[model samples]
Target: MRRIAVPWGVLALWVAVLALAGPFAGKLGDVQHNRAVDYLPASADSTQVAKIQDRLPGGETTELVLVYHREGGLSSADRAAAAEQVADIDRKLSLVRTPEGVPSRSGDTVMYPVASTGPGQDEKARDAFVNDVRDLAHDTGAGLSVDVGGPGALATDASEVYQSLDGPLLYTTVAVVALLLILIYRSPFLWLVPLAVAGVADFLSMGVAYGLNQAFGTTISGQSQGVMTILVFGAGTDYALLIVARYREELRRFERPYDAMRAALRGCGPAVLASSATVAAGLLCLLAADLNSSRGMGPLGAVGVLCALVAMLTLLPAVLVLLGRRVFWPLVPAFGSRPKERRSLFTAMGSSAGRRPLTVLGVGAVLLGALALGAFALPGSLKQEDSFTDRPDSVVAMRTLAAAYPEASSQPITVIAPTGKATEAVATARDTDGVTDVTRGRSGSGWTEINVVAKAAPQTAAETATIEALRDGLDGRGAYVGGPSAEQLDLKDTNARDRLVVVPIVLAAVLLILVVLLRSLVAPLLLLAAVVAVWGAALGIGGLVFGPLFGFEGTDPGLGLLSFVFLVALGVDYGIFLMHRMREEVLGGAPTGAAALTALRTTGAVIASAGLVLAATFAVLTSMPLVQLVELGFVIAVGVLLDTFLVRTYLVTSASYALGRKVWWPGPLSRRLPGAPAAPPAEEPALTRTP
Candidate 1:
């Protein structure tokens, strides 16, 4: 165990250097790509490509569209008043330019477009502008209604929500964890220990995440940032609690603190390592996702769990070694005291389960299978618009636009044709299947801009096929389709490629970790298989629940990635806890059935408790504004509960008992160590009770 420190130190140093170097190295690839795409020309064949390309707005600009209405046609007075207020607000805002185009007024309504010219523009300026306009609208209360929408307004709202919620979420999580620890341990210092370990682990994990982003050019999204904080705090504290709980139990038997720590580590180390590996593997499965945002979360989460493991095994032990018995303080006398002889509920449950393993296992399997019936109902559509908060101004604006001009919600597809071929291209696009409208711009710079409107939403497969057909209609004669629809097609293609490359790599990594921890070829395979089944069940159930029950049209792309990673990682945690305890019982010379029963009796309650806490914490994500978060939270919470209770407690126990001692066969680790005394016979009471 001491030898593990050398590699750990080196990894920590590497992560530190990476974290420091990452931000400056253009590590935020997505941000950079966004800038580049904004600056680049639409394609050589665009009719006004040259003029518009050079005049394109900078990437930082925030487009603001204000919609206002009055009872009578916007009287000259109303229009003039609104225009003056907008101009005044624009003048006061840094980096803001009057929208290049003029305000357009129609009967009883007016529209104003505003743009920010630079990245350093203060968001407060937008807030102030909205506030002023809102006040003006209120002054004309009877006749006027005002609503602001655009990238700027949406950005402001999102930023405010995040800023407001982040601190409260952190404090709430910490408070909850602290209270839970204090209640469980009944020792102030001991309760604080997990928090201390978690804090260190979080620092190190974030540093490593920053480093990975630098080295790999990964982009961490807002969602990942939120999840990372929660995972680090929650999982880190959970791991520490597991270790400390065992340490306290050991202290009741050992005379010296050092002995207690060492014994606790030896007994608990394998379990901790296994649990971490499973979690890391599960999260790493996200690497298989098509979305880079989803893929990035995998390694980011894995790094966090790994850091927590290192801190628990090293930093935590070092602290305990220094603190000695004083770590328990006023609780010292309780350490050596005996527990009551009453039968615990957990033990009774285990006894019932053991007596009718088939019935318990059968019922669990049936329930999961029933939920999984919804799998076929899952929709694969990934529309970005559905991801927003239900009441967001952007969504409201979109709905309004959709109502005003039903087809306005549809995106125009850009079909670029070689110079001098504008007329022919427009004709060809209009003739193509599924094409509803084809408008050709006046020839400019010898090139053409052909806009093709689709009958269906551009992101749908029908529209994608239409685009492909139009591109094919143009042949190889230098026509490129590039628009929102085309970009979505490209995104889909990229995601498909990513999914193929990532899933296998993540699975391999998970398998390797399992094999290394279990040191048994058979057990790793079975555990991985069980995890896969649980993952399938989770996704299937999530699909059904979200699709039919909740009326979500399609699964959030991020949800699938999140589900895959969480199911694998969290499922592994339960597997490790159960399997490790089973191994311990076997080592105590208990027969297969008794060993399985004892393992369940001892570890089942803790695993169930941990799973419930994690599930509840994750379930809180449903309260977030975004639909994606809600779906993700629900899926992960359900998956964790499934893994902890059904898979870990029943499925795993059944498999292990069925395997018996053969589960440990073909491994030197399973055999009695040479020159070491044999373990006591199975008939002897294994544990030495403190009482």
Candidate 2:
């Protein structure tokens, strides 16, 4: 009666919590922002420029370029039509000035540069203006085509892709997890339990995330929210797997469902808690990053992992206990019924690895090292046009402009100077090397805005040099030089600096967590070393594939750092699970060799399943239109797979086997008991237990 009442009480409590969580969760999407300014560090020159622009009259301008092109030379009619459209746009939209058409040297292409400040800082208004322009700038259909582009249009397109990510990414991730669970459990009702709980966890995380944003003004982005959802599902499902596996095993030994659950929690709760703590701790290290996106992701990711942990440990267990052994359906484990004994796949692999630990260790290390060499082949920082996997109108426009205006920049390098020093700043900017032209516009709020054009195109090294020169020349002159090109330059430099700071913090945090959990210095080091190797190898694989196979023009600036944080943190989870079980076996009187093999034999399948689920969740990001998400997803997913199969199964296991008791060095287990034999006793028959 008490057991039944407890389960009912928990269900009622969850219902109340969900009722509260439901509203806030729906509001999370409302607070999400994907603007380029949102991702930049507040201290960056580009961010300061954006902020100041918002304060000036008419607000930040939305710049656009209307590309009018024909395969052959543009006829007089085409030019006239282009002019008429530009005139209509100027009349209909609130333009900074009437746009003038610039014809290409080939006489086949013409571009009309447009700018409007009517939208101010309102994203909806800005998007509406872009859409209105796109509608008004219709193609001639007879040969002449039009593409509305530039930084503003590119931002709109990126926002749309980000907006689309929420629905499809969630559904795809859910479907993938459901399918995998169906296959892994082979039970009709079993998969639904964990999936439902994960959904609830996701709902809860969203609510918490929204509250954090509102209360603390934490920056929220599409990437961070999407990743939060993934963590809620991926990490949530992993905790579920470990819990359910232990619960299933306990059900066979205990008479009542409540007792069985209690035993199961005692068995696996430490590992699950430690796993979530490690992930949360490691993700929290991202707070040290100077990049706004990375910094925001830290809290959001930690929130996700912590929420998943709570749900899996509490709601999942209560629901499962209430359902009792019958939840497993046809394959339900009856009380006192032993699982089938057979030589499983993990048994064979473990035996082989244990037989030649050094050989297996050396070979696996070499394979990972060889893969790491491919990192050298990775492309440079991704340019704006190449950021999208699908070529939208904005990308097309940029490409067309690049081909047509081979030597000139269509984008402006914006410099904001003190109103008092505007004259001096203008003269200095005009005199700066690579400066093709300079125009002074908009003066208010103690600042004057200046637009400078470069001889080189946007994001090119020459343009980068010009931006640097502007910053250097303007140093202490109370002027800020920034624009799309300057923003990219700042982003690249900031990401590089962030890697140096965040990597060491993440490593120390994760290593400390591992040491505390394993109670052995050597064991934690081995696990950390294995996961780091996996990160490098996974990135190497991306290098080999991203450019040649995927046709990606460049890598995302944040890829290496983000991937390392995820891989090292998430990758170490499997190690903890395996090592935890090995420790358990050793404490249960099994010798070191027997324990390593035994842990692998018992837990490998579930670890592999968890790995598959996590990898697949991230793999869904590959299906996204954004190249950054795709690159990040591909690297992390590959790293998880490598960690699960190769590093955890082969290297860590073999290293432990070879090290014997020394794997537990600095712990009591490092020394043999008084009566223990030098050599371990024969191994016991392996059980084919799986969850």
Candidate 3:
């Protein structure tokens, strides 16, 4: 009765917590900050510009361009409609500066720069303003197309794409997991257990993430929040697979379901704990990042992982135990029945690997190296306007403006000069190379806003040089240069800097954790090196295909850092699973080669299933509209599959065989057997599998 009470009590506690968490969890999406400033480096020049601009006279002004065009030429009606829309907008919103039409050389497109201070510094208000403008700018027909576009509109569009991700991403992820779970379990009833638990864990994580946001003022970006969801399902499902696999094995050993569950948790719980800890710790390292989105992702992702871990280890087990062996349905493991004896695929893989370990290693190394060359062919940094895979009205309008205003800058360069040096700063900026024009604008506190236009297009190398020159020219004048172009420049430069700072920290942290868990320098380093290779190979594949195949002209700036964090963290997870089992066998007195093969044979199916589930969950992101998410999803999914099959099966297993006990080096497992063996009778391994 007490045992029954405890299980029911655990479920009740979870239900109570979920009830409390539901509202806060729902609010998480509301708190997501997807503004350009939200994603920028905290101390970047553009970030400073954005912050300063928000405090100026009109608040962060919404800069937009109202584009109206016809395929052949602007008809009389088209021209009148364009004028009428601009007039309506003028009456509808507060203008920072009155708009005037600029026509293209071909006379096919006409654009009007509409700057306004109506939205103030509120992101929601700003988004609403963009939405309202877009609605008003909608075409009235007769071969005329109108798009309300600019930085604010772009931000709004991007946010909408991100917001759209919530429903599709969750539904797709759940469906994918459910389908995979059914196939893996081969039991209609069994699949729902882990899937349901993962869903609950996701809910709990959202609430905790919201709390963390309130307490720490963490920057909750849509991407960060999205990653938390992936972790809940991906990492959560991985833990579930390991637990359930071990539970099934224990069920065959122990007579009672409760006893089986206890034994199973005792067997695999440490590995699960250690793996989750490594992942959490790896994710937590992102707090050191300078980018708000990247930095915020760390804690939020760790929270998701931790939530999933707790739910899977406790709640999932309780549910499974209460359901008993019949939950497995037709495939249920009865206490007295032994699984069919057959030569497993992993056993054959091990035999091939053991025969030519070095050859396999050499081949794998060459393959990884070849794949890494694709990085050089990757496209340039993704421009803000080209960030979306499917071009929205904002992108289309921006593109039109770019073509129409080819000789002049489509975006302004914002400079904040101290009030004392405002005159000299304005004069210096006007004289700077590539400065097409300069205008002195809003002033408050100790600073004045100076808007400048460059001859080069935004995010181009020429503009980058122009920006660099302006900074150099204004060095001692108390001026900071920023705008859309400047923000992009800062983002690109800061991403490079962060890679240098964060990569070493992540690598070092992961290494230390692996060493502590495995208790062997060689094994941990081996695992780390293998996963790193897999990451490089995966990214190379992304480089090779992202542009030519997927038609993405540019890669996301944060792709490298984010992908590294996930791959290394997740890749090492499978490594730990494989290596932990090998060590377990070795410690129990099996020879190194025998232990490696035995571990592979026993754990291979579980690892394969877990890897597939993780890979599929991540692949769901590819269906999202955002290029970055798609690229990220594709790379990680490919990497996991690679790590699971090629790396773990052939490479790690072969290396262990060739290296012998030294794979566990300096540890007691590394020592050779003390006595020469004489076969008295044929005996099977104590831990043979069912099927």
Candidate 4:
């Protein structure tokens, strides 16, 4: 396969354009429109409803509660200082004027609305506000606690967490990539090339993500940002490593550097392309999800993977062609040495398992089945308050609210009935099961606001049931319930829609890619089956660890869905790597058992090493402070390990051995095409080798 310079240039240009356009891209528009609509009161007439919405607080403004304690409740001095600090912060924040004006009030307890001015305009204002508040509380001799229970606070806390993780994540990713390259190549210059490619890939991916956000009006949350960074680094490095490793091996067979590069591309390009396609397709499946975050993540992540692949195939090779043998300087080579035949541990395992494919397959099936026992038992609730670290101001405030006014801690449900009908609706709703109180508010043209207070947390089962009951009771009466609890109900409904839509889409995409690459319907089906099993097992394990083992009462309802997406995408890596080796062995004319052995010995080491790196990179998320990060980190890490060790090693080997030559049946794609040599090609002469 020849390298195309034009495509490479075009890709570079496209990346440049995205970079230039980055700042102009507007923030991700809200994808949760239904959630907002669900919160409107049912009693208001259409016109009044619109007017009320117009006067309501902007979506960005959130009511924040700052809490502090002194020995004898709140001392006068402490109250005075805290009040002043709140006022100053409010004044400074006033510069960030949103569509809905900031409401300010002062007394023993200060209350105000904080507006988000995007990432632009006084970037340091929020930080400064937080610091100033903390300092004042300290100076006043009060045990300070700031509870930010508003949307703005959530955004602020998320940003802080990402910023905190960014530095360490970057450093760790780079260090890990460099270490891997150094071990693989032993040449400093050669090792640096792939890192450089990965860096470029990162910049290009981020630029594209920014542009996509602009074009599609999708919001890129803090979680997405952090995951994108780690993914770009890890995936880019892995792709580059595979290409470079193949290049070195090919160079051992050819006299010319260009020939070696071509040879490597011919052997590795198809595999890399296939692998990239599977992952990208898997990510693209997120488009089917109802959540804006999930849907946006799919395309953004796919773009990142595509950029990495382009760099690996084009830029890296072009640089290698230019550098020639000098790329591996300080190394000298001797000609005519016998080609080394590495031991195949995977092949041995494959052969042994091949003789017992059913047993191996059955074992894997049982393990996954057992793990999946926890699937139905998994809890599904959104604990936004606990999403952040307990130490965060928002979390603290939420906790305090839960203690002081449990009823008010959750979002208020606004039940709307026609102005004249609100009294009857309010009276009926107030008496409804699960409702703690129902307060009637200003009524307009045939509409009234009936505030329905729930007896449980907004995200709890009881609240959801209550919301449903209220909606059912007021059906066709222009009744609309809007508030935080209603929003949760909408989110839950949306998530359910996503699960139904995304899983099949991803599965089909992955299967299609595998079929095209492997040229065997049977193999793709089996591989997909393995991936599904691994995904289920991962979720089950996560449920056990987080749900029961760790005693985490809160639920990350989206965890299972997210795990499915990630495992299907990433788990394919091991399968592709191993299967490619098996094909190569077959092309070399090894008998079924011998070929499997050869594949295991030669490719097994690389897969194991790569899996280790990938798993470790994912495992780093455990150190992050947020619950989502920790859960995501553990699930992906464990899933990758299972894919690498159990599914790829034992299960695949067993199947391949059991099928023997039949594994490649029904397609000439497995056979070398016209003009391609059948026997193992002669080893290329080494251009250079380091002692």
Compare the candidates by lDDT and give the number of the best one: 2
The residue-level lDDT of candidate 2 at 297 comes to 95
lDDT by residue for model 2 over 208-234, one digit each (tens)? 999999998888999999999999999
**In model 4, how large is the Cα lDDT of residue 32?**
18
Candidate 4 ranges with C-alpha deviation above 4 Å: 1-61, 66-152, 162-168, 326-344, 351-357, 374-380, 404-410, 414-429, 438-451, 547-551, 584-593, 661-691
In model 2, residue pairs whose N, Cα or C atoms come closer than 3 Å (at least 3 residues apart or on different chains), thus clashing, are none
What is candidate 2's TM-score against the reference? 0.97
Assess every candidate by TM-score.
0.76, 0.97, 0.96, 0.79
Q: Give the alpha carbon lDDT tens digit for every residue of 1-691 in model 4.
A: 3334544565577567556745533222122121222222232232233345333333122324455433225446655666676566556555233122211122223223333332222224444554443453333444644444553355457556755775676677778777877876678688888788777776666666766766786546555655676677677777766776667766667776677788888776777787888888898888777666676678877877888887778778877766677787655232233345544566467666767788987887898889977666665564766665456766765555555444443445667677766777887797778888777754544456565768776567777788788877877776777555565456556667778888888888887787777678777777888888888887788777776765555656566677789888988866877766666666666654555655666666667766766777777777777777778878888988888888888887777777766677666534544445566632321111112
Native-vs-model 2 lDDT? 0.90
Number of clashing pairs per prediction, in order: 6, 0, 0, 30
lDDT ranking from best to worst?
A: 2, 3, 4, 1
- Supply the TM-score for candidate 1: 0.76
Model 3 lDDT tens row, 183-264 = 8888889889999999999999999999999999888987888888988999999888888887888888899888888888
Report the C-alpha lDDT of model 1 over 1-691, residue by residue, as the tens digit.
5434544565466457546645543332232222112212233222223233223333224555566566546676777777766666666664344543222333655556555544423445545554454454333445665666544555555555554555555566677677766766677788787777776676666666666766786556556655776677767766676677667677778876667777888777767776787787767766555455666677777887787788778777767756777877766634566545656555676666677767776776777777777667777755544555456665455344334333322346766666577677888898999888887643344456566877765366777788788878987666767654465455555555655676666567777777776667777777777777776687788777776777676666445555766767677776777766666666565665677777777776667666766776677677676666778878888888878777877776766666666666666435654345546532211222111
Q: In model 2, which range of ten residues has the least summed lDDT?
A: 679-688
